[model samples]
Target: MKRSNAKIISTTFIILLSIFCFFKSTPVKADSLTAKYSMDIELNGAKKTLAGKENVSVHNSSGADLKELVFHLYPDLYNKRETMPFSYTNTKNVPLTEEEKGDISIEKVLINGEDTKFTEDNEILKINLEKNLKKNDNVNVSIQFSLKIPKGTSRLSYFNDVYSLADWYPVLSIYDLKENRWDETKFYPIGESNYSDVSEYDINIKVPKDFVVVSTGKEKEISSTDNKKVINLTAKNARDFIIMISPYFKCISKEIDGIKVNSYYLSTDDKSLVDIAQSVLDASVNAMKFFSQQFGKYPYDEFDIVESYYEGGAMEYPELIQMPKYVTSIEIQTPSTKRYIDAKPSIIQGAIHELCHQWWYVTVGNNEYKEPFLDESFATFFTAYYFEKCEGQYSPNAVLRSLRYSFSKLAEINPKILNLPCAGSSVDKFGNDKTSYVQAIYVRAPLILEDLRKMVGQDSFLKIMQTYFKEYKFKNSSIEGFLNIIEKQAGSKIRDYIGDEIYSGEYKAENLKPTDEEINQIKHETLKEKIKASEQANGSVLGSLLLRVENGEKAIIVKPSSLTKEEEAFVNSKLKSYFGNSYNKLSIQSDNSVTENELKNSNIVLIGNPWNNKIFSLMANNIPLSINKTRVFAQSFSENSDSVSGIFSAKNPKNDQNIMLAIFWTKDVSTDFYFDTYANPESIMIESQFILSIDNKRIETGKF
Candidate 1:
């Protein structure tokens, strides 16, 4: 999943952290009892329903007799809002319509071609066998069902003419040998809840000819007619099967190391949108290459990345992933007014993270509801590792710094979080607070892995992971099993070191807390990097005041005392829109009420000319541009025309570490266009100096 929130620590010490090691190998797997599923499903697009019949062949590997077969009816959870795992608040508080409600109806069930007694409740289906089966027995269970596709964004949902079908079928539950029972954990909305054994799938899907189908395995077009089409898909040793259908799907493909990778995106005429899709494609290819070399060879011949509507971050399936459409929809206007070529870093990071699941969750399976950190943490750690080795736009140190910062801030809010066990706790333990859930599983869990790497050295850590992958390929592993692997490779001391941290969740929070000096240094370096990169690439400054404020720096907006209350409210509203949640940290004061301490320590945005704004008057000499009652002075020229306005930033006179951004006009300028243009981080160009006319036309803009 893409991290919705942000993380801590020192620079010189962190740079010494060992880099992850990469390895290459041939494909390998461990033999185990498995299930083979054959399904024929047809989609009724007009009614938003799927009618299907499924036959599952299961081999008993529990070393004991079985009396019944259990399956998870995941789609039934969506039958009503009350049964759904997720909160309606997360869905923008929009109630689901009757047509939007989803449900799965089991019309008939059979065991070995004979009628069987069955019960369905709480999203679980249990079929009682006619007689107790012996050890190592095989059973064929057939189910006929129909499904209603919900209208929304989720793992199994339909929205905007696209259908995302995952866990849309009744899947046989895993039999836990230790407990002598089937794994029947209920679906939890906070984290991944679908848990099943690796199975072989032979699926036949029938859809409208206009609908393009993307699914888990190798797909072959079977037949096509004027209005109907049939496709056959076969997947071997896959943990789960998923399908996506859309008539507006556009595709791009690349082959890496004999593995064909395809990226399916929504059809769009906008060239920029296509470029964003291409970016995701490129990131997926790079991540696959990096993870395959580092952990183990990718066993599959094909991988699919589908861009669709998902409420949260991207989700990982067996051979396919769901990439959020929001990534392609996002556009940032650069100083040159050209759309930024790079998509949001979250999209790139999300692509890499989800692909990592192919190695961890897909091939080497784990019970996600029981131990989500096993896959999520490992995926996140490898994401940082990819940046560290690939040397892309973001570096490992940058990633580490961000993580550390987030941890420290969260720790400040609730010190007890420092003692919470992320590795040992199950997903349900975190409850409904997604923030705390992410903080523990996604944020702190990876830091624990990094700490382990530092303790065992990079080479030993590499050997441990490689051995874990090789041993657990096509098998499910527990926390104990992973610890044994670490102990084998890194010895007892190293195992104990990580074991204590994982079980106790007691981390050295003080060590991770970054010092104020380090924070300031990073702030300055980031500002410099942004300016240098933007200038070198497009000759425009890309840094914005909003960025600084978002970094947790104190900010104050100083307006002229003569300004009307309505004008102040307008400025505040614009700032709120620009800053979003970060706006609450900002303060607004009249020039008469502004204090000297604020000028020295806080980032100041002066909203009036020197003549009317006292704080601007005090700092006029230090700024790059000069603004007075009659004219605005630039570095090379001066404008005396009425309505001439200037916006510039410079070091605060009282404190060089702070910044002072000033927006002043020679006369009464049109506040509508001026504030609407300059106050917005997306519209304003980042330069030390900028001059504009009352009509919102650019007069002069440059950096000092």
Candidate 2:
């Protein structure tokens, strides 16, 4: 019964979230009209601890009667004396706020230095204003607080030998204009998009001369007076800010496009650490050019790559990113003892991914908490695109990371349930990090874009992306808004596809139309060979795909041309059984341009686009990917090698909940890599010509 209820909730989130993105309209400038924020933080640091206070400036862009100003008290979530709250990303300090001895709360509400209306819900504290000011009226809110770090969670600021303090203080919540959905649930340990009114932050920190700090804003001034270092920082209009302080840290710097690039790491990091940081920056700056030229000029002074203790490989903040320096820490026991040692996945990939977030989340902000895919997918696709651009390679072996992940997740979850907002998904699922971050953010997203690229030319496609970024640069967006952009640029079919498949999890997955080169290759190799091999054969393979209305019973899934009439009849009969209703109704184009619905009728769809003579115009340099493979890759109707996907029936169908897909392929040698997820590779694999299936009862496998 609980399982049934869980399914219902998951579907709700998926549907609502999809409804927001699938059918987007024109972009909006949410930040331009709503508000802007800036900050100045002053810190006092020592050996085992550090403390600071911030002053914020805000402009109320909303016309509504404004009363409560919400401050996202992030660190307070960890102070629970019971189960300690923590994530691999941002910091959450325990005992973060000093409880006021006399009155209501630790925070002294000061609007223009006077008390105002304020309230606290869970950990988020909302401040009230004295006057209901009209739109565009500005105000200042100053917060003075001291924070103490728990030894386990301290990676940002530390006191004695090596105390690092991360996620230490209060930052502002990102407000959504389409709807101000204050997703104050909890910080996703992975990372998330944030909002705060734009302001100027002037911070003065007094730390020991031995300590060094890396932060979000520009370093205004640094001076030492009486053995105490005063480091002042001032940040412009950014969503949020973060600071990292440590005594045992070291720095290596480089310049990209004239912007100062700083890399921070522990002294223990190898010498190559500097080069790796530069590579990440070079790749990032190159990626920035791709986006800036396509989207808009990057809206900041500098971007940072700092070595942090954040779990996973890396995490992106507004202007700064925390990167994992070592693949195997001393804790891994022995590296040589282990045969492969996982090749020690470095911080390089992690840095590239996080820096890419600058465009998707930091600069052109989205509601990441609700629809993580908006950022994750954009970045995932960006990751692939950047790899090809910088490394001068194909979309690397990493594309399968998304393929397997989406496929497995699709089976375990119904798209209906998977679409739920991350906040709601947590209750529907277990933890927020469990499904939403993996599925909605990483898995399903890249495929949507990959499919988009396949449908349209890369030149036309990249133009649409640039327009989307330019339009939605500072505003919160709706699904309708996104649909409008695609509709105006791409054809209406694309808009509908986004609405139905990408948005509703009802994607066709029908093989995309191959280029003329690919179609001719099939014609020359298969049909032409058969014609030469047998004098009696008069028809062309094009005729088979363009098989007239008369031949349509359901679909014509022709395999190796050698077949008996009995086998042909058997295949036709099975195809009709699967697509009986559409069999007789379908027809092909005179030019043999197969439509989506026609392909949908087949038991297996083959969308083989040859890389020959085609140019991918993603980068300024005409980099090419030679994707020439001579093999028949086959999988069941639902069994695709690309992604493990699940189609959840919003309303449980009375029919049997059985879905077993068998993909048959004919190739000389199958590549041995990983599957079962977009990232994790321990699920299951059926070797060349082998079978793979998924159902609630059992996973059946057999070769045809």
CA-only RMSD, every prediction:
15.5, 20.1
lDDT against the true structure, per candidate, is 0.74, 0.47
Estimated TM-score for each candidate: 0.73, 0.59
Q: How displaced is residue 268 in candidate 1, in Å?
A: 0.3
> Measured by TM-score, how close is model 2 to the native structure?
0.59
The deviation in Å at residue 142 for candidate 2 is 2.4
Positional deviation of 319 in candidate 1, in angstroms?
Answer: 0.9
Task: Write one digit per residue (lDDT tens) for candidate 2, span 95-153.
Answer: 33332110112344456555566676565777767776446666666554445554443
Which model scores highest in lDDT? Answer: 1
lDDT of 1: 0.74
TM-score of 1: 0.73
lDDT of 1 at 392: 39
Candidate 2 local accuracy as lDDT?
0.47
